[model samples]
Target chain A: MDHPITVDSDACTRCGICIEICPMGIIAQDGPDDLPGLVPGGAAVCSRCGHCEAVCPAGAVSARYPACGPQHLPGGSAAIAPADLAAYLRARRTVRRYREECVDRETVEALLDVVRFAPSGMNGQPVHWLVVHDPAEVRRLAGLAIAWMREASRAGHPMADLFGVLVRTWDAGVDQICRGAPHLVIAHADAKNPMAYTDSIIALTWLEVAAPSFGLGTCWAGFFQMAASASPALAEALGLPEGHAPQYAMALGYPAYRFPRVPGREPVRVTWR
Target chain B: MDHPITVDSDACTRCGICIEICPMGIIAQDGPDDLPGLVPGGAAVCSRCGHCEAVCPAGAVSARYPACGPQHLPGGSAAIAPADLAAYLRARRTVRRYREECVDRETVEALLDVVRFAPSGMNGQPVHWLVVHDPAEVRRLAGLAIAWMREASRAGHPMADLFGVLVRTWDAGVDQICRGAPHLVIAHADAKNPMAYTDSIIALTWLEVAAPSFGLGTCWAGFFQMAASASPALAEALGLPEGHAPQYAMALGYPAYRFPRVPGREPVRVTWR
Candidate 1:
């Protein structure tokens, strides 16, 4: 609630990029020479998305909502050409084959450092990450999910058939849950907020897309996510923050193989109005 | 599902990338000269993720699940260096202000062409797109969303307070719902599959990130999405395919201004297990 919009007067050039870039249109300048200030009640409307600070040419403006001010834009323009980005996204594959070697904590940390920038509704940024670093722990968590599915199957739940296969797979020493990945990343947020669910998915998708850049690959842990959402035991095992529900999970690790091409996909199904 | 994973004997170099990349671990070859084939009952377990086709260096494998074959890898590697990609993702911003000029149809199509490659649950790829191109139609849809909010406010719903503000803003001609955006892109999918909801969000997230490359910007149309989800009338107005629910909506247009820098964000919050 204590969102501060600060300006470095000596460095301010009054270019007004921050004012123009503000989504809420709340930043204002009295004159050409004037430093921009938040309009009356601007803080209340501010989503704390940080456009003002990010758009400032002189690094003169800082939206100190989180207290971490703007970072230096490394190597000037941080943009990948559009075509290159599209190709990168296209060429990405859901990595199921992961090397036994565990990814170091720092690499995962660095990846999340970038993924945390993924957009959230009203910039709520409610998604919090839970990284299961220990491979044994990841397997144990998968076991918890299997246990839940086993119970559900016994109860003749609607997903009983799916659960039966998963439990059977687990019994056979096949990991249909976490895909034998060395690391698992779970996104959790307030369960009551509808936006939180979508936001978490967006964040996880960003993590999945960005992981390959870090020599890591990720697969959505659908089975684990199913159990996490339904089983209190799994939730308790995760020990996520209070009042938070697991939104989704991703199995992450160094991929055992590399993808060389972008696959052909279903034609774009669009109904243009 | 008749998911045929075939390999071209002539083109295959027998490097075995496809076999290694298969998430199901079902792709096999008896010897170096043997062409890769599915193990017994492999098709039953195949997630249809197309990893075999994407990873094959010789462009020999084809997971023709949807009858789509492998696409040529445009150039060898389209990957942006990790640091550049991280910086690019970090620099993204939600654009509220828009230029009057409408984005060309071709640009939108090209953007979607790339977005079609976005990953989905089990490669289900259920997310379908509805693009509202005409500015007048976009405004009319916004009006309908406002009307829905007005009714909800009148009904004294729990969200009435927020809807009341949105309705009032609409009345003031401030265009809060669509933000006067010339185009609106919506992602809708089968309501029964919970994965579709998350997949839609991921697809839209990809769209948002890829938009700037097309010289456009997008803001999540939360207000419109809320109404689209709750009001049958709005859903009918959207004319989404039968049995489909609107997962989310995004307002798209040429940005009024360019953001010069990436905004500051909250420190990455993680619970390392």
Candidate 2:
């Protein structure tokens, strides 16, 4: 069924571009008596290529792709390719333990190559990344983060439940959740710029998505990021610029465990209006 | 080619979770001398379901699906499938003009629904939204933005070239880009919160990815967002809370122009450690 590109008649300036650009010759003038409308009745068979979508200058048209969901990407491989998207999101777990092997610099670089393209607000492009490969340095940073979490937990902060789990794991002599992944990639951005964190996280998410493809595990290390903000010594050691602040950190490594089934979780709350 | 869940031996602490959870009988202790290595010649194929990822309390394991990129649940459809991660990244573009139709409330809600789940620093969840629906109000706000841009342009701001083009377009009887959209969604967070902008932006990116699938066009209206920040009257009208600051605004509608090819850009710089 073809749905005519719906436009607010009052808002339409008769740009006519929509009619000219429709790949399917379905859009046309409604004649002098009729307002501009689509031909072949109300339903227009749309290829869903989004050519009309990319061309409508008035920002008026809305196409409904019944099969498309909120996560669809226009012009990408699939707006919602089932295998890749599901596996990408489900595959990322907050990995904390690791084997002792070192991750080569080449692999880390390859991951960054993909992440470097993350969109920035106004293309401000304020985000920067720091890769820490020294094992000792990683441990030192992890120790500082653990110390912060321990103090917060002891002080009974509202997030103590999460921090408490971490402290207990640390006390149990389990490897640090960061698992001492030989490298720590820290994303930083201009603290004064409002969009820094968004840029950093987008890049980080890209890295997360790309990590599993490379057989590397990643755990978001918020504590380390916060530590960079809260402690000058940590920030200095990370070589952060004067106005730069760390937004997120990922501890990357290979997993030491495997489970057969997808883990259960509280269903995410999503309301369609 | 079954790899034994290669672990960074220096990074691992001999945690027994791998042995405890290996569904396949591939994992075993390599004698007391060889710190818990997986069998050298095992043919175990990782299901890559991320069960170990979820259960890895230490946050050490990372699994990458080579073909998939980041996965997200869009508007709560069954898990969105993944596509070629590289292809998806390559295909993303910055859309500007839009059509003349109004975006449905359901579409906006769906986008918000998906983006609302963006992780906040410490789960603060402090971000707020102001969805502008009134066409008249949208025009009024856009006029103010145009006024601001004109002033800045005359003052020879570095963006004068861009503003000149926008002004020229408006003078040529085309609707201002900011006013061209049927909906304006503004993201705000507490001004005092250093991470507010970052939080807002991550949420915005979520919306951006999810919008096109529903046949909606989105443009980053950073200048308008900035104008709102500068104009207290406008901010108050938008119902920004006393302490909250508007960080981003997006123009959403149908697209105005179509390009036959994805735009190419210079490669971004990325270095491996």
Candidate 3:
């Protein structure tokens, strides 16, 4: 990983913008007019946040580690207006009931493509996704979650009462664990990676937030995540990548209903310093 | 707490949709055909997730807990298209250098308004905010973070080398901690609330993702967060609620430069089961 960054000297203006923009303070210039490069031993401590590449005014800097790709955006500061973006964010809802029709791979892949850009600590980008593409497999996972809850209820755990209710609800065939959604998307990472949990949740949040614009809906699968954390049976069934655990799970599908109105939330509390 | 949900009888069709839609399964109907209402002790168990309210075909069911508000989406599912939303999200770039202009109270409040709808654990919605509004105060906080880093560097901390570099960078007059942004937004919550950390980060992420639309920019103040977590000097200066701790912080201000293209991220890795 020597010199994880490269400079297109053909386009370089020796402006030192990349050197100044490096979050790791790893890039350096030999003189005021010299082309910038990583200081000695820079790659070892580089956070891979890609600030150097993105901040290059001439597009002369490129970070090599993640494999950079070109992306075109609606130019200037007007991609979408403030009002429109606010409206879209406010309209997002935690979908409970999903249509039985299966979601296509291309649509789901598009979602992952958008989500891959979601931020991570030091740009570790450790999260990998597990999509339970088969609705039947999702159902099996939900059933295993219910099984864990029943055991917890029998053992009188701290949340035993709630578990009892969930178990009874499952018995009544409500499929509340996964909300009977046609698919489940789980973000997994090595348990050893300190950033894995927060990073995965952020990516999932981005996925859930962006899904609606894709003509899809998502719900945080809290029940399944709870069971997965402690239930070996459920974990074994999930068969996540070796050395990895599911950080969070999201119920993904086309929603069965449309929500035209955005519901209120608790009044925001703030302290101005 | 009784009857947290209300129904408009005129608008109600007795269609059994609300009864089936209640996530708590607390709504019930009587006889061959009956209007749905909360069963005995319904409100206590209600997750307040607003499924019944959002799922109603006639908009007859309203959850009193959240004080439901009328929100007009672009109408139908035609808000922003998938590709456009992805483009906008991808275009988001964290600001390291920002214009000196101060952010207005109205604009900050607007951002908070949109963020209030961000989902939380079981609708717990525990997060509150702290705005270090003055640029001078933001600088003070950044200096405090540097002070902490200096102390960490003095000791043989595992991250001592990185801290030493940051401390030297600070001594050389680069405000890397908060990036000299005009304002800092810190999400905080009661230490007892388990959902606080994740909820706060999600809300902050939403704020980061949507800032570009508002002609503003943000960077996760990871350095400030590091100091806030373990530095008594920083914590006392933050002056959060008595029972609360700062979950995460973001540096916010107008950008010094525009990012014309979306930078690439790591490849999307997925397992389909």
Candidate 4:
């Protein structure tokens, strides 16, 4: 493959910063005066980590991002203070109660954009997102999940007790499934991929961690995820692409309540070798 | 579990904020001037999410944290700027190459402390950590993983091709298994726990995200994890508590290089329902 990056000679100083910065050592400058390009077979091995384009001192190294079109964005820095970050992590709560409001499209989009940088197995970013945006749609999906739980309960599944409790709560007009959250975000990938479960959960974890920064709240929608994995009806409802299946999900919305204190947890159990 | 919280009568304002904020509605105030305590059977249902103690205005309420002792800490606010957080997320990279220096114990401790707040299924918080602080130990464990891979390769295992590549690299001078990182952090839980995989991965995701905050870097040790799951030798080397098995691990250290730019990713894929 030709060089993934196109160097504009006018702006190129040929300093080789990109070559050194390339994580895969793919970018090469044949001669000190020549512009940087990918080494032979470089494209096949490139993880597309974007380190080359990011470290370029000159504005000349532009790599094609077929997904977003070609764009060279500067690397982000650790601007947050340690103390504030400590507080931020401590402040996060598993928000199960949400106000009857929807997060605007732009805000949700921005949050996903941040998590897009979350790492995946071998940089094989196989996770795709399915945003259940409308509250009604979320409600319908939750119903399908309940449908599975109800059947599982009748069939005496291993988790029958838990399913029975949830189904009863749902029947009693409580949403134990999605927790009445207005939005549900599902992370999915090709079911055949071994890394799908881990990558999807990692991406969702990133989303939940970053949600509060946008004044939003989230809870792991485990019940929905469990049903999505088991119930063909729920799978049909999700309508993921041809080979994709849901691995995990989160209920998303404006929090109706507040967690005003940092509750202490069990002393971390660690064995240092 | 007599009222997990102790309310000081003299300092109690009896505003019922605790009652209102309790996610389980377990906290109760008998009279307008009365101190708050758990409702009948409330303790049984309480998730110990700590919302009641956090929401109290008076310094009267203190929750007993066996893990942390009796303390009521103020809830942290979202003090981080959204833009800064966006940049922080973008700046993160999966460091495959690491500097040889070891991270101090205090820094590793601080990172784990922040992750203690990460959520778990049913508030189980079942994940425990094992930090391999010795580089030699890490190398030894990597050799065990290589041994498993070497056997798998000879047996023509399904992943034999991938295992072959890793084993060949290990036989070479390169440290392909642990990436030569000074420390390895393993997240483990009871093998019987259904939530172990998701919960452990979520916890490790928290760790990797929080690592950058401590000027530390991490790479998911998937090969090591795979071997640990299948190899009795690696499991015996791990020495996790009885019935606990390794779920995931990360190579922890300072990065050898810097990523100066944020590489472009494929455009975000979303299906709006």
Candidate 5:
């Protein structure tokens, strides 16, 4: 079979760089046109790595990702410039504290306007968002989340210590850590679908990236999401649809604190092939 | 728990727009610190949504994502201008096919370099990449993947029909449906961690958004990832660590075809609160 990306024979330079760079070794000379072409006379196999495309200096090759097609967006194809990407990547953060003010309905609608544009699996668009602004409802949900954590803790889950912190905070008459933030954006997808997490993460990432440009802070509330998924009352209060599982919950608000410098960390591990 | 952003009180106008615009209802009017200050007691729950900052006429608020901190990059704070954001959102896609030619090593390295900067759950950074370049190794892994599928088919799984297609394709001596794309980028994370998929998705999304800027195409390959996770031979061939589990995969290549128009889609369901 022809690889999803086919080379134009007319533009062939045969530099062999593609063969060397292929992470999967699917590209080869004199390969069968059918039966996954990289297998040698039905002997070899290709991993479908695009290293060859990146390595080719002749500009003679072209590649395509499957399942992606033209006309995929509401307004059509618009290119994101490098500068914009740099800005977007630089601005996103996971926020914890918030100012004690209420966000207006208009601004929430505006942010949703951009979030609706987030990409989905196979264009299935399975992602759904529940925006909670009422202080009472947010707190109620947080209570339910703590209850779930207590259950998990009793079960000896490894992260029980973290849950203990939340429990203690609530018990000490401190603010409800989960609901203290005024805006709770809960992202959900069909629980039955394997790709639900992917859908939620993709949408959440889009929202997080866009938030910085709007001057808001976001925190990925895994505890809340897990609790929502585990507790039907919390799910109902959050307005998650039946059969839809909450994958991520983000708390949005203004910052209550400041740091003098970026937190320190060890160097990252990276390999060059 | 202080949030990561703050507004300069001296620069405040008390116009009430920030409170109204905040998605998280953390902003409120209160006399704290012996002065009428926009106390951020609730800001600790911020999602970093950016609405308050974006709408602020005076630009008093500033937030910085942890990954884009001063120590990592030279910029004090980066924000994608509105026009640039419009362009970036427009260009995103999920590509699958690829050209037969090789991609430059430096270019692939550059892409990986950006991915290295992606955030992880609690800075775990458990995610690992298996870049397959050798055509033979790619083929070996693909064959093992097909074998796994065949085994699943014999067991009478629901996806038997899909596997039947693979069998028929292989029998007819045609190309693998995965395409003969020469490169495959596999992302794996710790199996024990709940955030493994989150880490993988974040890194992959970063790469996907950045690929178009370099004239490359990408497609997420969940099926391939599943196969690798389920089959030990495939996992070993791909060099996945003992405790690591595959979370996501993608095919990359040069585009053999281009469509003149962006694809159309149904309007996403969005609620404005």
Candidate 6:
């Protein structure tokens, strides 16, 4: 296969940074001023991580695999200090109670735009997003999940006890399903990709970590995901792409309360090797 | 069952924030002077998120679940803006080439200290860390992984072809297994925990994202992990606690070079419901 890379001869200063930075050591040049090219069989083995395109000083190299090429990263005083970021991450609360306000479209777009940077296996980036924006629609889909749990409980599923509790809680007019949040975000991917599960979860974690900075909160929508996987009707309601399966979901909204301090955790269990 | 929470009445201001914020709606007060208490059967359904203890005004509420208590978060001018953080996350590189220097114990401890805050299912927080501090030890482990691949290739294992490439790469003086990284950070958890895999990956992603801030770099140790799971000797060498299995590993070290820009990715794919 031909190398999925292009070098702009006019713009190229031939710095050879791309040759040095490629993780697979695929790119090579015969001399300092020579234009770098992929070594024999390098195209087939390339992980498509784009380090070459990213490190190029003269905007000379481009990886065709990513399709989007390199991005213009915003920098300067806006950079976060390690201590401050640690504090921010620690102070994050799993918001279940939400104000009766909708997160605007632009803000959600911005959040996804940032989350697109989350890493993937060989940079395959197989994950996709399904956003349920309307709170009422979120509730409607959640009600379908409750119906699934009701059936599963009656059918003596192994998790019937848990399902029964969820069904009973729903009957009590309490939303134990989607947590009454204004929005629901689902990560989905092709069922066949081995890395799909890991990559999607990583991307969602990035989303969860970054949301608080935008004055938002998230709760893992475990019930919804389990139901979406088991119930055809719920999956139909999600309207995900043809081949994608729902991996997980998160409830999102403006938090009803602000957490003042970071709660503690179990003493970290570690064994240094 | 008695509630697992303890409240100090003398310190309690009766502000009722805990009652308002408990995700399970378990905490309650009967009167203006009454201290908050958990409703009957609340302990079983608490979810152990600790919002009550974290939100308390006078530090009066304490959850019995978390071994550690509330932490004083460093706030104010240190907090990062959304744009800056986006820049930081996007600009991160998976470092393969590393400077041959050991990261001091204090810095590694500080990084783990911050990483402990990564969220988990129902706040179970089951993930554990195994840090391989010595470079020679890391090389030894990598050699074991290569040995596993070499044997697998000879034995005609299903993944033998892939292992053949890795073994050949190692023989060619390219340390493809561990990439010559000085430290190997492994996240492990009880093999029985259903959420262990997801939670550990989330926590390690947090480590990878947070590392760049400390002038460190990380590359996912996929080859090493594949071998560790298949090679009992490598797993024994890790010396993880009983009942725990390695979920994932990452190679960590000071980067040999810095990339100037963020590589691009596929356009974000989404479906709005």
Candidate DockQ scores, in order? 0.64, 0.09, 0.61, 0.54, 0.17, 0.65
Off by over 4 Å in 2: A1-78, A81-107, A121-128, A133-137, A143-182, A188-198, A209-219, A229-248, A254-273, B1-83, B147-179, B192-194, B258-260, B265-268, B271-273
Expressed as tens digits, the lDDT of each residue in A1-273 for candidate 1 is: 454688889999988888877767788989999878988888888878788787776878877776455676776567677788788888777877789999999999899998888998888888888999999999999999999999999998998997898788789998989999999999998888878888898899899889878888899988889899999889899998778999989999998886676666778889999
> Candidate 6, residues A57-174: lDDT per residue as tens digits?
7878877874555775554532567787778777877887888899998899889988988988877889899899989999999999999999988998999998998888888988
Model 2 chain B poorest ten-residue lDDT run: B65-74
The superposed Cα distance between candidate 2 and the true structure at residue A203, in angstroms, equals: 2.4
Best by DockQ: 6
Q: After superposition, how far is residue B129 of candidate 2 from its true place, in Å?
A: 2.6
Candidate 1: TM-score, chain B only: 0.91
Model 4 achieves a DockQ score of: 0.54
Query: Candidate 5 versus the native: TM-score?
Result: 0.68
Chain B of candidate 4 achieves a TM-score of: 0.91
Per-model interface RMSD values are 1.9, 10.6, 2.2, 2.9, 8.7, 2.0
Would you estimate the TM-scores of all the predictions? Answer: 0.91, 0.58, 0.94, 0.90, 0.68, 0.94
Expressed as tens digits, the lDDT of each residue in B1-273 for candidate 5 is: 555556677887777665654545567666343212235566556655454554456656555434422333335445555435544554454544457876776676667766665666655666777777554555566677788888889999788987777766656754353455566777777789887888889888877777776677777765577678788777777766678777887776665543233333334455434
Q: What is the lDDT of residue A235 in candidate 3?
A: 96
Stretches of candidate 6 exceeding 4 Å from the true structure: A1-3, A8-16, A57-59, A64-66, A75-79, B1-3, B8-15, B41-47, B64-66, B75-78
* TM-score of candidate 3 on Cα atoms, chains taken together: 0.94
RMSD of each: 2.8, 14.2, 2.1, 3.1, 10.2, 2.3
lDDT of 3 by residue, A1-273 (tens): 467889988899998877766777789988877778988899999887777777677888887875665554556533778888888888888888889999999899999999998988887889999999999999999999999999988998899998888888789888888999999999999999988998998899899878989889998998899999999999999888789988999999998877766767777778887
Q: Write one digit per residue (lDDT tens) for candidate 4, span A1-273.
A: 445667788898987777755656577777889877877888788777666666566657777646422333333445566667878877888887789988998999999998888888877889899999999999999999999999998998999998998888789998878989999999999999989999999999999989989999998998899999999999999999999989898999998876556777766788999
Better of 1 and 4 by TM-score: 1
Q: How well is candidate 2 docked (DockQ)?
A: 0.09
Candidate 6 CAPRI level: medium
Worst 10-residue lDDT window for candidate 3 chain A reads: A69-78
What lDDT, from 0 to 1, does candidate 2 have? 0.60
TM-score of model 1 (CA atoms): 0.91
